[model samples]
Target: MAGLEVPTWDPQTAMLIGAILFEAIILYVGYGGLEKLVGPRLMELLVGGESGVSQ
Candidate 1:
């Protein structure tokens, strides 16, 4: 019977994956903060005064 082989951990691959994950997190947080800072103003500009329901 053949046994299943376990995958080995490669430091370089791990580092690359970590870097990608870090960048993704940074972009997410950065964009979220930027949205918070500019989203309302942008919406108002596009909608022409006020961003929500009117009445």
Candidate 2:
């Protein structure tokens, strides 16, 4: 692979990976919090007035 530039690891790569991991963790936490906040309402909406009997 002539003329192809090979990338090297540096502080920038570390920061990039750290940023990605931080974002993933933040996203997971945010979604969990949102589900906790909205789960009941969503269940009611999806389940309707059926209340108990399952199909």
TM-score of each: 0.81, 0.70
Pairs that clash in candidate 2: none
After TM-score superposition, what is the CA distance of residue 19 in candidate 1 from its true location, in Å? 0.2
Q: Candidate 2 on 3-28: residue-level lDDT in tens?
A: 79887779988999999999999999
lDDT of 1 by residue, 1-55 (tens): 3668777989999999999999999999999999999999998887777756676
Best by lDDT: 1
- RMSD (CA, Å), candidate 2 to true, equals 4.0
What clash count does candidate 2 reach? 0
Local accuracy by lDDT, each model: 0.90, 0.86
For candidate 2, what is the TM-score?
0.70
